[model samples]
Target chain A: MDAARFRIRRAAGGIDADAKIINRATLSFVLALLGFGFWKSGFDPTVVWRGLLVIVREPDILINDYVALAGLGPAFVNAGLLALAAWGLLRVTGVLISGPALAAIFTVAGFSLFGKNPFNVWPIVVGVMIFTWVERRPFKDNIIVALFGTALAPIVSEFAFGIGIASPWNLLAGVVAGLAAGFFLTPVARGALDFTRGYNLYNIGFAAGFVGTVTMSALRAFNVPLSGGFAWAENGPDEILPFLALYFASMIVIGLVEDEDALPNLLDLLRTSGRLVSDYPRSFGIGATLLNMGLMGFTGSLLALAAGCDWNGPVVGGIFTLVGFSAFGKHPLNALPPMLGVMAAASLTPYGLEAPGSQLALLFSATLAPIAGAYGPVAGFIAGLLHLTLVHNVGHLHGGLDLYNNGFSGGMVAGIMVPMLDWIRERRRHEP
Target chain B: MNLDATQLMRCGDELAKYLYLRGSRRVRISYDFGEERSFCAISAPDYLLDEAERTRILKVFSGPIQPEIASYYGALAGRRRDGAEIELLGTMAELEDLMVTEGGGTQIVLSRREAEYFGKRKKR
Candidate 1:
């Protein structure tokens, strides 16, 4: 049955009676972020604008927390505005703001807190538009890919600001690099799915990793020195924790209020192996999807806090990405195992669980949730363990230009583990 | 639903490969272009699809046509012969019929309506 049919069946059963409510709910969520951001800034235009200017001028590599660069007010404002713009783009393209669309939107918002920005992201988006035009295909067909492909937005920032080139030429080179990255992203992303076989839900990250590696290689060939560092805000948890708790709690409340069958539908959703294309909104109702998203948000926050990590920009961004993907793939049942695997691995390694890298590994390891959903917790645990080690090492290859470094590592883990697991399963069946 | 001719052909290719893997040596594929809908039927005369197999295949094809997923990952449909591949094919097209002939052959018909295809295009 289609989503419309599913809705009709639910309505007939006297459960979820509303249709097209997810869009309105998503719009309201964006608006609330904007509202919170303005309130936090005391509605001072100068403060917000200055913060934004600082953010846009930054190189925005890995660990460049906007909160530390500017302040809490600008970070949230940037995230909220980017999310709003994404929502508007989807609307203009006639794309339904459903599970995958929401995933992309929230990811944009999440990464905006650290890496992506309004100025750096546009070149890549325009490049995708040009690709669509050249191919003579409707941009709507590839809008989600274009949105997610902004994982390489750092490439634009790096070329424009970080590299020591003259002003106009530097800007020109950055736009050209960004355009090339975006133009090739759709094809590369589609092909990269075969490598992981859809086990890694962040396929765009995997693709961006490859593109970033090439771009980095080209830059290094010209003797361009690339440096990596961190800009973490140590005092972020005090303010961020309360906001996250309230926001997630509201999601659960709204979900229950909207659908009588939200709990049952959520259970049904959890049973499926959340492989690629496992759209919760289309399979389950929006109410259940919202509930799942809320639950996953809390799960991510709990894991980070329990590991003694602050609710910094990257941590919050990771949590938001986890929450968004809950509607598409991740859920409490499947997402927990990989996180546990990362935590367990951190205990044995020299990197303490409280370290920023370890904290992020714990949260972003949920990219391998489909492994747990498909092959059970043990496989998921192993995938997460492997992902932690590889993620830390692979950043230099892309020079921290690829924001979803965990995703790149997760793809490698899936590509290696899935084939081995399948062979083992086949051998076990024959042995029996 | 808004599929081009190449995409429709890819759908046929996926069905062909699936049937080939399931002990169908000689698969016959035909297309019927009507005013409202375009139909592609792939039939295998040599293979007798059992009740369990028929039911499983029907379940795979019974899911909704997710245009968003199809547009993103549709190219991967026929490349792998895993359950996920078949499931992805399910999201691409609507199942019209699965019939067993008197000679114990299986014919599966999948469809895309011109109205839905053009409708979405016009919206663009």
Candidate 2:
């Protein structure tokens, strides 16, 4: 555990100690979960251990990977840092580690598989730490949210690495950029919560939009164009089948463990479409939420493997992110329909659905669950379809500063779709 | 818990809108602020509302501020006899939602006079 994870002041109930235990336990358990998927898929844990050794022993591959494909181990470390960070923050701050906080932590971890890596995470984390020092609050205070604020981790990594900045200077530039992004994001996230009225599930997504716009604009001054016209991620039956089974099974176990009798209520939650600020823990208890997180992890893992995605660095990180959000506002009921819609659109369009990164975009971009949750499945489907088309081009606008690409996509989806749907409803009402 | 009569009136309006949205026929908003017994009733079913839509209002309550949104529902939940249609207008979720959106206080009422002075309102 890093200092952030262990930096809590003592609480009345000794929750600090319990939190530490749980945090470490959570890390180990999640690692085991990843290890299981990795091992099951014929990637040996020992081999992965060897791979980890290789990563530390030889840094050249990472440098080489900068342009091609970033690996997953770095993501796990990044996410692990977040989890430790969250635990530390809660312990020190004495504020409970909220569902959103937990969800955010998981999201950081999961996305680490895809876009976030330890190399990228530090600059953002350090920036947040500096924010704590400046704010005069303990670094652990609100630390949980700050950890998720790392949605911009990619900003630091890619900027430092992608800009052709070499070696020590490359990391320095990335670190500076990342910390700036992190320092900037924390307050913006707090403020954006009000605008969305907690009606948008991904407040961070909304915050990232503005952040990306600013960062991208700043980058653009140098003619560093960040966003492009469009892009798509991948998906398929293989992923769908395995993930569907794993997710449902986990849900069943969760249902059974939490309350076999809780089904009607749990099912009712599904009927709700999981709108923003939906407190499943308050409504259904933490057990069910945990079950959801586990299932989401299983499902995301299956999605990754099915895509023939390497269990390497970036991919695992992405899976962890998807899994983490499962506990926050991205339940399958709230998330999958949009995914399906995106996939459906990808199939028919000139943009071949199986195109590189298209399915990944579609799968991960389900961050727009608030659209589906608030409006129902049809709108969710539509939002997903639109999200896929727009996500690619929007990233450059933020100059890769907004690390949550889907969040950028999500903000657009929410900003546009919410009003349009409301208008449609209001028009119908007025017409009749 | 000094009650804001004006704010109470706004709460009434929101309650009215909520009732309308739920596709219910009639809703009765009431207040039993010790000496005061006040209530507002809406009879239009065309005033339907989607549960997702809500207005935030600040209410003055005494004690732990246990606002019984259920009274409206209990009043409405029974049979619609003699063209009588009734449904629960406000619920715990509404109160919690209102509290979150409004970010106000639910002051404790130690006495009736204090109730009238603090967060106190009775809709009957």
Candidate 3:
């Protein structure tokens, strides 16, 4: 059965005991993570409110570095609130709480740690809603895509206040840009899928990257200097380390509580190629999916610590994204190869291993996990190497407008590599 | 408990009905009944046996049957460029020797006694 049908059946009183427990546990875990961030930020809701004002008023173009603008406490609080807002939207929409939805929610929260805030993310969201209204379709149809589509949200922030124009004109231009981005996203994302054929998990990211590129190019032609911005926080990892451990450990405990076969099921999930359309919640049950996500998060945190990287907003955001994707199409086996490949490139190239850009790339490299899953580890390593090399250069195309820069690079790498792998597999099958 | 000709026909009709409801089209079932065991071949264009339908059929076949006289074992055999072949084995006793393929399609050869079941029998 499809996810929609499964949800219907669940609602019709045939609820699986394991599924019920797992759903509650997953929601609780997210709420807890957010609460911890708030607590760590001294529980000052007013500070977060002020920080959010600062986040919105500024031009949040690519690499704007939210952590640098807002203090760590406020930035984390903004992320937490944004995640909660996404959760609330799911509730209001009466959408089934599934692995995919969880992934979307965590992604919002993760990106909130960096580029997304309640203010800028919503215009793109409303723009998507406008698309659905004009198309006369249910909002649920594009809810997931709309949330992920906020990769272009930076365009809204940049156009709104960054451009030197009078009040009404700047605001009008910003709204128009946001509406256009959201409107074009559906068709562009759908078309881009054929290019990757479901190999690159961040299909929307790739689409947004292209959209961002074209939009940025158009604006730049008129002499709008789209500055490529980047900054990282220099916070010590003292509190962040313990928080990461607890957050991931809680996920493991919740998984164990929800399912008896979580360990074996998680291992089974790992055996899959982590391809698109692989929903762990449906296949291995929600409990095992949560287990895999917890493990993935822990693994990401460990890698960051080993590289001597701080747990800043972007780094945490990247880790959150990797962990969230584990529910949809990521596993330890597939994710590790690309990450290690990035680390290798960092060491060999002029980039320092602990550089912010390299660390961000290392975490985002999980976007190419499908290659590792489908091919062997060696192929995965090659894809990762290619991704790191291309990622730094691709930013110039959009001038840092596309937030998921690694995703754009991953799509290109997969487009080039998967067909070759398919050809080789066919030939080997025919040989001898 | 060997099935009579009428019982054999009923089994085929019932199985075909099950497959048809689950999206299989142009299903063809060929059968041969011996004194002790029976052989049946069920083939349809591979498109009909999507992941969901395949899983459904396996569940239905393995599920308990009232007044059980025989147990069914299924293996996927030949594949057309378009679809695949599914074979079902019904017996009063289970086979001791089972050949397993890790990644290849499952194939179970018909015995000489059941050779007539080899040919396709189109259903109306």
lDDT (C-alpha, whole model) for all candidates: 0.81, 0.50, 0.68
What's the i-RMS of each model?
7.3, 19.0, 20.1
What DockQ number belongs to candidate 1?
A: 0.26
Question: What fraction of the true interface does each of the listed models get right, in terms of native contacts kept?
Answer: 0.26, 0.00, 0.00
lDDT of 1 by residue, A1-432 (tens): 122223211323221233366777678778877777777888998889999999988878797989888888888999999999899899898776767888998899899999999888988888887877666566877898889999999988888888877888988988988999999988789889989887898999999999999988988898897545578888746788888888899889888878778888887788867878777776677788889989998888888878888777888899989999988889998998889999988898887687777888888899999999988999999888898888778888888889988888888898899899888877887894
* Model 3, span A59-113: residue lDDT tens: 6766666778887777777777877777777667655555566777778888887
**Candidate ordering by DockQ (highest first):** 1, 2, 3
Candidate 1 segments whose C-alpha is farther than 4 A from its true place: A1-19, A227-229, B1-6, B13-28, B32-38, B43-67, B79-87, B95-107, B112-124
TM-score of 2: 0.63
Give the CAPRI rating of model 3: incorrect
The alpha-carbon lDDT assigned to residue A79 of candidate 1 equals 94
Chain B structural similarity as TM-score, candidate 2:
0.29
Largest DockQ belongs to which candidate? 1
Model 2 spans with C-alpha error above 4 angstroms: A1-25, A33-82, A129-141, A158-172, A190-200, A223-255, A258-262, A294-318, B1-124
Fnat measured on candidate 2: 0.00
- Displacement of residue A46 (Cα, Å) in model 2 is 12
Give lDDT: candidate 3, residue A132.
63
